[model samples]
Target chain A: MTSKQKFLYFIYLHRTGLSVTGLSLALLLFPLIEDNPYTLGLTNLIAINALVVLGLNLFIGYAGQISLGHAAFFGMGAYGSAIATVTLGMPPWLAMVIVAILVALVALLIAVPILRLSGHYLAMATLGLNFVMYTVLLQWDEVTGGPSGFSGIPYLSIGDVQFDDEFRLHYLLWSFVMVSLMLCLNLVRSGVGRGLSAVAGDEVAAQALGVNTRNAKIKVFILSAVLASLAGSLFAHCYSFVSPDSFGIFTSTDMVIMVVVGGMGSIWGSLFGAALITLLPEWVDMFETYKDFVHGGILVLVLMFLPQGLVTGLIDTIKIKLALRRRKNVAS
Target chain B: MLRLENVSKNFGGLPALSEVTFTVPKGQLTALIGPNGAGKSTLINCMTGVIEPSSGQIFFQQQQIASLPAYKISRLGISRTFQNLKIFPRLTVLENILTGLTSEGGDSMLMAMLRLPYLRHRERSLKLRALEALDRFGLADKANWPAEVLAYGDKKRVELARATVGKPQLILLDEPVAGLNAEETATVAEQLRLLRSAGHTMLLVEHDMDLVMEIADQVVVLDSGKCIATGTPDEVRCNPLVLEAYLGRMGATA
Candidate 1:
């Protein structure tokens, strides 16, 4: 290969790494460019949502599994951390780590039976799990603070550096997002990733090819839950609050929408999906009463025109346009 | 290397296959031919452990495999292609072939997630192996194209490449050339012969008489889920029961 061709090939092979590095750099510079706490706070929320979406996409997009109960895991992380730090008097970082591991174990227990159910059946089961968790958080009044919500949660810290404000919390949250992105990218390019794709494409075929479809589904399900739980911990620390209302069925549904709107099977799509969905209401604040109506209308339009999700659809459009231009040039 | 004895399958009191018996010798192409509803598919399903047999037993390499799941059967050196195309539509052709190597190595999910050096080496080696398989099937240039985008004939070849990529001890091909044109059928026939020459044991389920007669080392004919005749192609071709099964009794008499 020519030197130029070799360089381009190298870039193609490492595109995932390059893009991740670029996104991390952009994230690091965002706070420096904009000192507005409100914007940074929104971005931090986007990062937390993206963290969950990245893992969820692996299950939904790659492994071809459904889950409507991720909010439960997220809530588990928040409530677990809150209870550990406030009621049980554990350190903030220790609480976060311990809660994430506990939530993962809970998810594993739930996944074995639930992952057996596929399609809408799986979705319904997960939805039931979310409702169950929400109920527990509400009825367990003394511990969870019930409908009024839990408060007095401590800010996360590393030695002396405390994430007390949105600006400081932004770095912590985005770092998690970047790390998760890198791991997820690494996963999809590996052997297990190929097995997951095979399962997603056709479960029977995957089995015939020696892929344990059931096992693949359960593994991705647990991984997705752990990420959501970690994000839940971050959500609690960032806001210093926890509420059953925040981790209800609606939030779970929103995460699914982000995965779809961002594009299935595309990692970068997760980030864009989370950011767009989270910011949509804020952007359409002028039409307060018609907020949901406008949101539904836009989603319908997007699905109608770009069924592949925003990132993938947009990328395909650009490629097509470029190809057309190239053909015209060649003809001329 | 594989034996079946009195394997029967019933669905809701209706027998799809009844008391079927056969033995497939290793390092040879054994073609399973039958009329419609003759239970060819049911027999294949039983052999692959897609469904448990209603009665009797199946043995592969001296191990009873009737109760094992499909993946376990595959891992025990049995692989199969589908009647209808089941290629991973969204995945690239190379990735599709890589999936066949799942039972071989690099199975650590944690190592994959961590992007460890061992997995990186495994990925590269697996990719090279997949590319080699694609090359053998004449799909080398289209390795990066999504499996769905390939033409019907090419898709069949991709399935063949995938089934053989892992170098399984036994391959069950169901209508491998069902939708292909004459030219494509000839291509697949050549690949099958190559596999036979390489000493791979294959059970071919096909309807095309000429291709089977041309390439099969042994032919087993089924009529109403019973083995009517089994012998060399020329011998089975002249069997009275086989003639009666293919043509009606009156036609056979004529």
Candidate 2:
């Protein structure tokens, strides 16, 4: 095969690799051409948000577990890292790793009881959990600084190089996003991923086929919680701020909405959903007063027509159309 | 070999299966036949650890497996199919079979996420076995298609292929040929016979008396959670109690 043909074949073999590479290139070029700090900041937020949603999507979308309290875990990461550095006297970079381990344990303990619930019960339980976390963040004045919010989160530095520049911070965030995206891509094709999908499809059937559904559910839950907490840690370091209002119950609900709007089980849906949700406010700014109304209306349309979420729905439709056209060609 | 000793399951004071005792000899097929509420499903559930028996011990290869979890019991070499057809609808045909056969090395999260050497080794072996299974079931052509899109009989065959591929010592086939046409039912019966000839123990819970008579080395009859008869097909056919139970139920319904 020609080099072009060989490259095309390679793309076909590693489609997610292709998409991630293309995305990285686009993200790299996006800020250089358009040097608006505000737009760059928004893109950075999109990457961060996309990271959290990827875990949330794996939990709800692939594992079929409902989580409405991921914001609590996210807050834990932010506060955990902040407290570790500010009070515990840990290194700024080491604090993220330390806080991640602490948050993962907390998530495991919480998930034991939370995962016992099914469907709407699980949603309600997580919703209540986010409220409790919000209340705690507001009430804990000494450590978290109460309603005024926690501040002075140190910038993450590599050796002597501080990520103080906006472009550099953006790159730092995307690096994590890229790792998370590739990790998720590998997970979908992995054995554990198949087991999770099997459990999601039917718990009894999965168990019959030797999949430990309970363990699978718990593992996915812990993984999701850890990701949310990691995102929180990144958020704190990314913006140098932490607030109870930022990790409210609505934020938890928003995470679920992102997964649903993206596609329930599609791996690429996380990026698509996060990007849409993050950029949507700017788009709706065109209709300044009726922003919420326009946003609600557009979301309703997306759901009404694409119940499986945009990414999977589009693919399914294309496959069906292609099959129909093939049959028509054969018939003619 | 597998044996169930005095296995009893009760739900809210109602007995689903009471004191059911039986043995499935190695490499032989035992047909468990019953009426609508004969507790055949409940028995299957107990054997496969879907439910803990209210009382009794289950022995597989002389090891008591009654208290084990369902998945653990499955790992201990018991596989089953659902009467309602519990195929994963969203997964493709090949994936469904791969799910059954991929339990060996790919189950570790770290191994899979890192694409470790062992995971690749398992994947390659599993793909070979999965392809072999599909070819055996004449499903190679439909391997890439989603299980939901398959015809009802084809889906049933896929479920059977999934249950039988994982090298389980004993397979519980709950109404394997239910909802199948005459030819399709014959094909499934032939497949069961092939499995038996290969020295795989099978506990077939089926209502098709003709199919049962054709393939069953031993037959056990159940009515109202009680095992009323156990013998060769001819012996069971001649048993007064078996005739009375079937004829009496039919007469009452008529």
DockQ of each: 0.57, 0.54
Alpha-carbon shift of residue B114 in model 2 (angstroms): 1.5
TM-score of 1: 0.95
lDDT of 2 by residue, A41-142 (tens): 898888888888999999988898888899999999999988888778788778888888888898889888878889999989988988899999999899
In candidate 2, what are the lDDT values of residues B138-191, reduced to their tens digit?
Answer: 888778776776779989999999998898999999999999999999999989
List the candidates' TM-scores in order: 0.95, 0.94
What interface-residue Cα RMSD does candidate 1 give after superposition?
2.7
Clashes of 2: 0
What proportion of the real contacts between chains A and B does each prediction keep? 0.70, 0.53
Give per-residue lDDT, candidate 2, residue A127.
Answer: 88
lDDT of 1 by residue, B171-211 (tens): 99999989898999999999999999999999999998889
**Residue A238 in candidate 1, Cα distance off native in Å:** 0.9
Residue A58 alpha-carbon offset, candidate 1, angstroms:
0.9
